[model samples]
Target: MRGEVEQLVGILFRTLAEEGYTEAQTALLDTYQSKADTDREELAEELFVEVVTNLSYHLETETEVEVLVTAIEQLLSWFSSLVEAAPVAILAVETDGQIEFWNDGAERVFGWSKSEVHQRPYQDVFAASSDEMEPHLAQLQDGKQLTGLETQHQHKDGSIRDVRIWAAPFRTRHERFEGATFVISDVTEQKQREQRLSVLNRVLRHNIRTDVNIIHGHLNQLAETVDDTTEHLRVMEDRLSNIIQLSDAARHIEQLRDEGEDGLTTIELESVIQERVTRLRKESANATIRTTLAESTAVVAHELLPYALDNILDNALEHNDAETPLVEIAVSTGETAASGQTTVSVADNGPGLPDHEQAVLTSEEETQLNHSSGLGLWLTRWIVRNSSGTLSVNKSTWGGTRIEIRLPTQTS
Candidate 1:
């Protein structure tokens, strides 16, 4: 009798499956197995009633199944098109790091055919780097989702490309690890823009602060010399000169802020440095200026490239304590496993900053209202942050401070 009942339940489940009552059919099978004295006809009637009631509720909530399905299909189709059209690589990998699916975008960005990528280990696509893989693997292992992770991926052509990846784990109804889906976006250009903005912001702030200090010193002198007509005339002349300098500084700051990352255009970095050095030489006739720029070193930045160079040189000269201060400028461009970048170094034969002062320059803390001398460096740091580049201070070859700024070469 039990055997007959089992056979009857199987038949009912098959019938329901054929009628598209997938979930209801599974529920009926579960119920029949749990009940010791199962009545086939009664169980079928109960399942039918429950299925109808549940479907009716869903229909009321959804309005219409056909419409909902159509909308869903359309959305899926649109997403499919978008994934196909995107320029960056995309892949879905199991929690075990096995590739489950690869989109056309993956082929375009990673230079791998679908057959070559599918079911392969995700680590195969990553180049060997000390900082690579560990964080991503840890996140997956911990069952936590990760997003906006910037890393380098090895392409089929033996080149590495910078990519911003977002990953999230997927699960099935049985609560099993389905895998993780990754969306990769090429961010080489964005990174470069950030670097340029950082450098520009730093240069602007440093120049402004330096100009303001000079203005302050002149104002102090004017206040003291105001008693006599001859002294007052001298003070007036000094104030006028300081005002002009301040105005130029303000204009330069505005230009840096306005140009942003999009302002980077192909320009000869050597020429920009040379022009800045020439101007510095004229302005600081007593100071010694030298350059060691690579003749072929080219960079992409706004028309204000000369200004950034000028600010660095100006800082070196203004901060120096030597009788005839020396400023050394060096430029270099090179390719790395990830991308190409240009580095510029401005060093001065002056009193090198103490370790604590160097810390203050790089810290995100706002410059102190009362502290003097380091404000220019603070501003330079800010510009470097905006440009999406890095700024570091170290001992120069001349036993002074060296300010190094590195900017990415590519936009994307």
Candidate 2:
């Protein structure tokens, strides 16, 4: 006697044949046909349960076989086209880390056909660094799904590739553990472009900035001579320095974006702030620069903290038209019931921050109109954000702007 499941499938298959769904149905079955006998049976069992569960309404109502099969065929066709149309590599992996199914996209990507790689160990064929594979394998072993995982893969030609993967664990109809499905996207070109940009930015900010700064220093000394070209040299020097500052801010912004919040670490904030303040005091010798830092105060932040702070302090000093620009830095640290916090406040007796720039600093979104004038405030904002900190600009006691960076402590 035929079982109910088998009988249902038989009736559905005949109706599919009559409705011209045989080709799509055959292609769907062919995927399971490629697996080993045991794996094929398991996959079919899962698929059977899925089909039965989905069409339970039709079965209960004794709906016309033709209607049911047409619905099934449409679903099958959609699945087939979806699998075939995917642009990235797709693989079905078993629990023990063996390859079960490799789509055409996978074959084109990894340079191996399904016939060649079927039933093969996944690690042996698709190579990745142990460091990179460790987390993924652990996740799979725990029957967990992962998405948008960025890692590297070794190619048939012994070349390395940067790839992103979205993977999920599968299960059988009886709730038995099966394997994982993976979609991989190659990102070698994307990674290479970022590298090239990093190199170019470093050259512009470091080497080029260095050469221009030298000229700026010489121009300043020449401006004191009262020569005919002294004023022109001074103007050129000032404008050139502005450009250099923009480059510096841009470099800081790039680092913040590339490294992200996870790159923050613990460091003594007092020393970094003091070192930068001392340098700024010497640079603007006429300006009165004061600092109030707690002893041995530390904060969790990116290594670019000194550079970012310099930009803030530089703006406070440079934008001042006062005869004696007064800029003060106050550093403090404290603890709450949950976490500790550190704050660095830079208050200046200069023209307050521009409304547009303040809007950029406070904005959570980036649009052309609400963007920073250059990169100074934006860089500071990103640096603070990436450090798991907050930035606020408001009126200072000296009738100027006070920029504050508040950083949360890293939990042990």
Candidate 3:
């Protein structure tokens, strides 16, 4: 009996040591040596063997019990390092929208330290609109993965940041709702880049289409008036002039690189609209132009403000069906305590744009709507987008198309 008791004690110490629980083994050894019993010796030996065998099976064979645990530990370590090393903000929130983990990246991106953000509600970290948070929370709860969600995020410094968040829900061993993990990256630069590209595409499409159509019409006229060589020569000169203008415009567009949003300058909104309206009147004798611009609305942009306004005006004039095509430019301004964005609308009594046309204009494939290839309105939309403005096509009061442009005002 004494020998069996000693054997049980030996097995417990051996199993604990093998598991790297050195302290547990030493404590068990002392307890077993003191509580040595002869009558229950056989039972203790059998129990000890069963416990060791079960533990070994758990560590080696039970995939969910052991493998998953080790994998999770490694994954957690890797994710922690990634969040700490990343340049963007990152956070892990529970199912209830409470923040469980906040990384250094979050600190750098949102200007909140661990002490400030840990275990707090995500809403407390930054001011978020219900419109923005509701949809995101719904997606997380549904276990649907979301990517590239663009919304405004208020910063600790009282400035607003345009942020894009990618998020997915995390589950526990029982497949129960644990929380959500988010990897947020600053996409402000990328958004600006897309806007710039859209503007360039719009300019190219509108100018190319208009010039090509003009050239085609002129050629057709020349063919009909070929009997008079003088008229043909005059038509040929006009076409050549159009070609030269297109070449110059192309050069200007090519010079616009994938630049950052740093060279933005304050621009007079009324002046730009007036210039475009005046130019359209002189260029399109067949079209009647009108204006209702506010006296001193201003915005921020590069030198492309004139070109963007020109594209909008040209689209309105070209698509109009009135005997004397009439285009109206209306400008207005407003302020929101939140973003304080200035709104300027350029509406026309032209034919309303098609649904597909609107979709193409807002999409990244805006270049596909080339005027030379039948994509004029699409390009105009691109220009509005590039200037950090919103463009929408709706039914005009004159039973035609209304084009609205909303731009952000420059901060004083």
The candidate that achieves the highest TM-score relative to the unseen native structure: 2
What's the candidate order when arranged by decreasing TM-score? Answer: 2, 3, 1
The local lDDT score (0 to 100) that residue 109 gets in candidate 1 is 75
Model 1's TM-score against the true structure: 0.41
Quote each prediction's TM-score.
0.41, 0.61, 0.44
- Model 3 segments more than 4 A misplaced: 1-75, 78-246, 283-287, 336-339, 354-357, 366-379
lDDT of 3 by residue, 136-175 (tens): 7787888788787768787778777778888888876576
Model 3 scores worst on lDDT over the 10 consecutive residues at 368-377
TM-score, candidate 3, is 0.44
Q: Write the per-residue lDDT of candidate 1 for residues 110-202, one digit (tens) a residue.
A: 788999977887886665574577678667656777777768878888877778888877766676677788888878677779668767666
Q: Which of candidates 1 and 2 is the stronger one according to lDDT? A: 2
Report the CA-based lDDT of candidate 3 relative to the real structure: 0.66
After superposition, the stretches of candidate 2 with alpha carbons farther than 4 Å from their true spots are: 1-92, 100-120, 128-139, 142-149, 154-160, 166-178, 181-183, 202-229, 246-263, 279-295, 322-328, 332-335, 364-373, 397-399
